[model samples]
Target: MELFIRPNTNEINQVEIENETGTSDPVVVSINRILQQPDSSYFLEGIIYKVPEPLRSMNSEAYTPTAISIGPLHSGRKDLKANSLKPIYLRHFLNLAQLSVNTIVETVQTLEQRARYCYTEFIEMSRDEFVELLVFDACFVVMHLTSWQYPNLDTPNAVNLWQSWNEISHDLMLLENQLPFFLLQSLYDLFAPSQPLLEHQSFIQIVQYYFSEHKNPKLFFIDIKPLSVDDVKHFVDLVRMPNTRMYSHEKSDQRLLWPLNATELHECGVIFRSGDGIEFNDQGGCLQLPPIKIYDDFEKRVRNLIAYEQCHIGNELRNRVSNFAVFMQCLVQSDQDVKLLIEGGIIENYLGGINEITQLFNNLGKHIFIGINYYNSDCKKMKDYCMRRHHRWMTSLRRNYFSTPWLCASSIAAILLLALTLIQTILAVFTGFKERS
Candidate 1:
């Protein structure tokens, strides 16, 4: 058992509390009694009584960290001082802790070793950085908690490693589920209880930290397929951003990770091609990072983007039928994200309300939508697009209408001239006798 004394002010003398454990009874009782303070007064700096034997015993069974709790300080350091504190000001810190049971705060980090990426860095990090990284890494943890089939074996750091992984998984589930209400409120509710080791601990601070000062290197992944390294070089050449760093030959102990937050922001997947020459079909790098600190901005942006994306596809489908089918069919080529969204019921909402679609034909007799003027009207766009695309497949719905014949204005004028010429010949024949007389 170790007694770590903390002081209120810089004066080490006023913060002093001495340990006086008696030679009688067991060491555990003496350790606990001395920690209760001879003086009934509260000190901002807590003093502890050290006991080697029993102190190690209780903690060994739990495998949890030695709990250090922040005790009675009534003021928000910036708002209320010792003399100026009201009754409400006193319990603020405890209230704050109760609010923060589940939230995590950490900063942005690039991809590195998974254990080293999350574990070693989590320990070395400032409290703000730790929480920020924890927020996104939590998402990854939730995504793959049950699958501990990798390097997380029984090492000395196994306990800490599992705890980190478990907590991260728990936190991700929390964030995803609570996005509807005040995100900051949800953050405070989860993170309040954690002992404040670093200054930036709030959920808002975690987000602000990302966009303000956090940035990682650029990243792009490719599964080594039939595509040559020279092809990569050529592709990079077309992306002609001179300052953009390119590294084809970089290798790592774990997975390939760039030290940039790009992995944290984008939705990622692996790309591959199948052939006899292929050694591994599953190739390409994963962007392994968490979401950004966009706060409510994230939700708003997502809502707008999804809504716009759905409408854009609808419009394009309305304009071109075969193109739209080709698009859906082409998605079958690599149907991971797209298929998931479809299965998740995101697409059904768009086209389900309409009965059928309208179609137009191109000069080449290619089927398309005659919907250039349709936009100004209040029509169901998504269903319109889907039906127009599906119209050719429905052979039973054929009908011939009184359609217009192809005729130019000049052709109409020529027919009128022919009628006038016959009229003139008849009129001349009737007037023939009068002209001879």
Candidate 2:
């Protein structure tokens, strides 16, 4: 059913989330009607928020000094400059005239802040996990930007070789908050699942199963299997044609995707929605993010570091821990009102709990920082120690995680070799016995 929704924008007003197709009568939506006016407008899932768009793409080839833009809304990093920017590692960030200031990050942040202020209901997860996903998404953007900025015209790799960034001999650094989402997406396509399938039918079966398996059914963070942009496109197509089964039982080709409800379908159609909520139709679930700005040619260089990090970063658990800490700190300290789509899901507080928590922490921080000494000096010191230990535990976790892959690979190889040797010995004994007979 065709449901109408306001596209994500800087100028959002009362937007109605209509369930034109009477399928979903979930308590969440029913509750919403009672709490809010029918005509009242609200932010919905899958709505493409108005974000900074680079006017007439320009990269190193077209512009001098590699004048890449770090959009105001999206730059999570604290520093910004015009000419020479601070290098986070190798890439440089500078505001360009062509790049717009509006970004999804900013828009979302604005809503988050508002929700906090208004005490709106929010879906709560591990602060660190949510942040880790943010980093993961951001890394994807950086990877794409870098890949486009540094095209393979003068290099040996004309094919997608962003994955092999270890060949670089120079000390490269990004001078600012780099686009990370685009980076991850391009690389993700290059390395999708590679198991042998019987046919298109088998392939669809496997792929469908892969997407449906709920490693994090309620939360689509850091799971090994990530939903791609293509998946979203396919899902959009499905929404456009509701009668057609995305995945066919008899046909060799089937598209396995989770269905979206009226509100979810409408919301996700424009802005990307987290896969936790119920779509108008619950065929299954999806992780497909909406289309981001594509990075072509030399612009790809903005991403090499991110690519390298994903492939070479050994401390996965530790990295997650740190990401979690930062995310938690940000969420706990955030003074923003966040929004949560609790229409099709079973979130008790929805977006409300977040506001409550953030407010709780805000008050605590203010009291502690603003001469309202609630805790004694020793207690404060103990708190500090606990934080330090918490961080240390994360580092240790990462170390253990890094060790697993090598250990598993080596063990598997050894076991296979031993099995082969045993088979050979058994064959030899059987042959000798047959010859004697």
Name the top TM-score candidate. 2
Angstrom error at residue 159, model 2: 22
Lowest lDDT block of 10, candidate 2: 366-375
Task: Find the candidate with the highest lDDT and give its number.
Answer: 2
lDDT of 1 by residue, 1-437 (tens): 12322222223322232223333444554354446543322222111111122322422212111111111111123421211222222223224344332323321122111212211111243344434433433332211221233222112334443343433222222111112113233333443344343234443333323222212112111212233222211111111111112221122233211111111111222222222211111112221111112221222222222222222232222222222222222222232433332343322223221121011001111222233321111112222322443332321222121112333444556678988998998899879967998
Q: What is candidate 2's lDDT per residue for 96-168, written digit by digit as tens?
A: 1122223323433433322222111221323333333333333333332333333321123423423423212
lDDT of each: 0.26, 0.28
Residue 169 displacement in candidate 2 (angstroms): 18
The positional error of residue 422 in candidate 2, measured at the CA in angstroms, is 52
